[model samples]
Target: MSIPNEALQKILQEIGQKKAFAEQQLAIVKQQMAVKTRENRMLQLTASEVDSLPGDTNVYEGVGKMFVCTPIPDVQKRIASESEEINADMSNLQKKQDYLEKTYENSKQSLEQVLRGGGS
Candidate 1:
């Protein structure tokens, strides 16, 4: 049987709206992923710099290095702790990204089905 024109139009409109919303959500998720990755990279760099510090060496070559070497022990410990926190945050964001991806896919499929007039 042929689908009613009004019903088909309504379905198409709804589907289009849903697909657009899902696309917007996916964009937000992408932004979040990028931010998380940048933050994680920064954390790793800080941790590496801290790890290279030699606690026993009081005198250093450069001014910046000398300052860092002053509180070598504390700085190393703080950076290690921050790195752990950033890692945890990264794991959580990864899980969120996976979930958002699945949601986007499912919404797209539903929209396709609706537009095709496969409604029950």
Candidate 2:
């Protein structure tokens, strides 16, 4: 038995929707990754700059609208921790991007097959 024309159209439409949704999600994930990567880079640079300063030099960390005087070692530790968190976030986003890419490809393939009269 073969799928009726109406049902086939519906199937095709559904696949198309899935493909579009996946594309949107992939774009968002990429944007998020970019932001996180930039933040991580800045943190790395700040850590390096802070490390070069004399131990006696005062360091300030931004807290809300004010900069709170903090120790060099404390600033370094905070930067390191923030970098780690951003790295983890980027890794998770990468995994999600991979999955969305695969999903989009599969949807495209299925849509092509259906359009070519190869789908049941």
TM-score of each: 0.66, 0.94
User: Candidate 2 clash total?
Assistant: 0
Q: Return the lDDT, model 1, position 70.
A: 45
Worst 10 residues of 1 by lDDT: 59-68
Give the alpha carbon lDDT tens digit for every residue of 88-115 in model 2: 8998999999999999999999999898
Off by over 4 Å in 2: 118-120
Question: Mind giving the per-residue lDDT tens digits that candidate 1 earns over 54-77?
Answer: 757553324654533446666666
Roughly what TM-score does model 2 have, to 2 decimal places?
0.94
